[model samples]
Target chain A: MPSTTATTRRALLRTGAAGALAATVPASPRAQGPARGEPLRVGVMTDLSGPFAGAGSQPLFWGAEVAIELFNERGGVDGRPVQAVTADSQSKADVAINEAERLLGQEGLEVVTGIYSSAHAVPLSGRFEQARKIMWITSAISTAVLKDRNLRYVFRPTVHSDQYGEASVSFIHEHAQSKLGTPPERVRLAAIYEDGPYGTGVAAAIEANAKARNMPLVLKEGYSASAPDLSTLVTKLRRERPDVILHTGYNPDITLFLRQAKAGGLRFKALIGHGAGYAQIDRLTEAFGNDVNYVYNVDPVGTQMLDWSKLGPGVGDLAKVFVERYQAKHRVRDLPAHASMGFNNTWIFLEHVLKPAVRKTGGMSAEALREAALAVDIPVGGTIQGYGVKFAAPGTPMSGQNERAFPVVMQFENARGRVVWPTAIASAPPVLPLPPSSPYAARS
Target chain B: MDPFLLEALVNGVLLGGVFALPVLGLNLVFGVVDVIWLCYAELVMVGMYAVWFLYTQAGWPLPLAFAACLPFVAALGVLLHVLVVRPLLRAPPINQVLATGGVLFVLQGVATLVFSTDFRSLGVEMPPMEVGEVFVSGTKLAAFLAALAGAAALWAFLKFTYVGTAIRAIARDREVMPLMGVDPRRIYLITSAVGGTLAGFAACLLVVQLDVHPFVGLSFGPITFMICVMGGLGNMLGGFLAAFLMGLIVSVGGFWWNTEMSYVVAFVFFIAVMFLRPQGLFAR
Candidate 1:
């Protein structure tokens, strides 16, 4: 192997004859038959170098990359090649703003997606609205982005924070109380959260739900995202003797809570997490191991078990092509939520909207593409995740736009970490009573 | 206002003392060596993970795990000095800063690549012991007491021991220490090792309260540095004072305002203090 090389390309100038510079650059055609749908340019901006990079932003980027690759091969968007340029926001709002401007104003990107932190997404929403560019966010579920400043161009593909809380409450009430036979009143709940926007939002929602349901939230604690210790806080939680512990923290905080809870013999009737950091398969296994039994997380669930063939031809054929190519290239099993979400969305947009629009207009201009996307009808007949995607009317986007296919309340059975939720796409019914020493065991 | 609030505040102060332990070590290095040891946070992160592995993974008792880890921290410190610090000693301050900064990133990258980005907390709840009206957890009180005891031990080590005296003398004047037959390079290595060991010692107490992540090092790194500088560079006691002050700011501020706004308040306080005292609150 070659040794590590530390080469600093701080300053490299383009100098020489104008002819040489022009030679190096690819020649551009001045005019093309009134434009026949060129490569569809999409820009992705998200945190890549800050605190939240490893958590989801990087993984989300991989998801989008997979979608673009699949789209390009099977006859690009409406037979026009799709081009994607991704930029890292560095988790800075100002930087995100600047990059969004460049992507919109300079690159003439028709669609923009991917902002991991809500702090960045809130501002980016305004920019996208101004440019009338469509923005599809997979992560960053700040409800504020959806409300108060709702924009026509902005749409979130993944679950929102409010939906997360509501889904969590419903799942507990449905699964924990009825299925697990957990008594409603005896449900002593505690939330260990990081003192940040994400944690606070979930904690507040949980608190409200717990209160309205007449369940006592015995403990409500917040710690720094990078807090080094949780023994004391966990100890206080133990005293409360909560039957259910709802932790709303990032991956590191969750790991600490899991390890320390086991070490201290602080057993709970059910252990549930808000899927922020605990959703990943490897993270859960590594931090808890056998101890992860009965731990349930409310996160994005993919339709892994659903047979794509049942959804009919176009979508099913696309899925087969994607699965074969992806498996061969990456040598991995079926794509996770981060991969499948984008794949399904891209497939929907290309076949249902982009293709017909390009056929009608004879070109893939911004106006033609927008009209096509706006006229999307049969949202869910696709083989991918059974989502049935469609946009809601303006001023009420949440009511209509949220593809019923993806609601974030999937149960991960210990045998195989498959998403079993929304019943329509679930491979199996929610495990009636979480099995012992398995992930859902404690929650049982 | 309530008992929980009081407990959180007291715990914050005690935890703040533990926070000071490593920051104090950084100050010790800064006071004597005049270079910010950016890798000091990584030392703490590694030390906490060391304790986690020894006690949780290796099935050793907590004390044994801590004791076994101290020498490793010291060895790491010595290695850091020989490889990075010593070579950049005669260079410009910026070079020294950049070199140590590089070490910090190298350690963080190694941690991310090897350990994987996951959260780990000591899962067990510490037993709560009542002291008057306030309820304190066993692990937290232990951390608080350990912080106090460690601080006292550090003070004694710097004040009474011959090697400690030599270190202090070198801090005052590196050139003057040559008369006492001590190599400046050797003294620096010893001081850094001492600082690293102190960080390790602090970590054992830290994990007792929270779990350690590779990135937790970066979290505490800048905050502790801020505490050290705000308290007055090279003043160990001032670092302790500043930590508590910042701790109280976060705790009490969080109590009154929303938790999110508390950080903003702390930064405001820091800026105000900086404006008032140009150099710092207690700069030597």
Candidate 2:
């Protein structure tokens, strides 16, 4: 009787252990309906709140929604539907890392995309690399994430600061120098930037590019991002009297500096900026009225400026679709750069890698999805800063540069930003010697 | 290097005076009441918004806007003191801090929700008056002059007035002050009002020199706290001296080193002062 009882107890223990194992294991398949598998999960992290809320996040979500719908209509990635889980990073790096961890670890998301700011992407690069998950940076421009860190899982689909800065200098050389009837030497340049990585990095690149092209950078000024006043700096700029001024600043700072410069009778022959801030066409119109006529800056990828009707395959009619959907839902005008970025970045993920991987695996695993994304060879051929997309080797100058496209220089004319450089993608002629009514000319 | 350093120091001193002027009432109230005015920064924010609303929305002149904001902010201050600070005074320091902090958040939320966080620069622009290597704009000069005058006026009011003496006494001991024939509550209300008015004066200078943002209040609050503590918590004269020193440090340090580290050094100074001389450099 004791031997029999011991044997039964051992059998019961094995049974209980087997049951627990089954409970912990994910349920495999249902026989009847669609292919026996789970939906492919893609995580999108965006700047939902904070300073870059509207400009950096809205479009990404919209683009994802559009792609998700299109992919589902064609029968989901593989036979399983595509699911997206988006979280707000609030433009913070730490929050971004935490969200990426949750999506990868808890939700078991196969692929991730869409960090808005470089600040958010820089730190999260490590988390994604450790998990061996794909991180498609849609809007962030900081190069340090891929360049300094050698993050294998990271790939950037958007233009980096260097490209933008270089483009601006090129635009100045091509448009301003000849138009002003001045040699490169006569065209002295001054650059004033905000004291963050974005501003500092861009300013350094602009200076380098200008020097490479034999353009003298007469004045270099770094001002605090949250400085209460720029009057002292503006006064100094006036005294230096550079022929051209390139400012890497946010909207408020840009407007404030111009107002102060005008008051101080400071003048520059021309002014240009990288596309990070001061790209709001409408806000500039409202603030300065016709003063925005010839003040040129590299423009953000706003769909309104793109030729949506002529877009190539996989690019879709983004400009029209964005405007229509955005207007219908938010009752707002054209989608802003932030909104445009948000939407396009999400679409790139769904079309480029998500759908293809789901088809291959009959289901999505984080590892499989990352492999599929690496194999993707599509060009980001949209009107919003057209570029070829691919990843750089984890440790290379081309690592972040691999999948990123260079931003085209665009000019702001009549309070509207239109692509004007890289003659192939050029949409319009450059605007030289900003309008007389502009604060630039008035200060001069 | 020395010439630019000297120039930068002068500039910092001038700017520091402007930064300190608005913070005086806040420091005074904190020293006397033992209540950290979490809304102290918001006081300045509100003052700025009030000026903007009066000047732009209400179609008033610059001077009118400045004048109108003082009483308006003062009233708001008294109301805030009664609603938020008064009830929480006897609570734990953490609770007092939290209650005032709540007021700060509410004010920030309301401002952003209503006005939006766009930068509203004053329309009037003035030219800078350049002297050799030293460049000072008309607005900066005006801000410096106003800050000086305001500081002097407040000093006189505190030194010569009966109410000012009562306020200082109340700050030291609120319950015992009533036995000395001072109504602690009335003094609290009046002191709160004075704090708001000084914030208003700072706001006017801010609009003249810089653009106003709904979130600008947060940027300056901790710096003011540092100044107050570094100046000797209850000593107004100490606050002035610390403000000038802070100004010199920011301007010169910014020029000589990375401009971004100006505040970092100031914060380090704060920590050093807190540890080495908790009573502050000018403590009696």
All models, DockQ values?
Answer: 0.19, 0.17
Model 2 backbone overlap count:
13
Writing each residue's lDDT as its tens digit, candidate 1 over A254-308 gives 6666654554446566666775566554445544555564456666555454576
Model 1 residue B85 CA deviation (Å) reads: 5.9
Which prediction has the highest DockQ against the true structure?
A: 1
TM-scores of the models, in the order given: 0.75, 0.82
Writing each residue's lDDT as its tens digit, candidate 1 over B37-135 gives 877888888888888878777899877888988888888888888888888888998888878877776675566545544445444445656665465
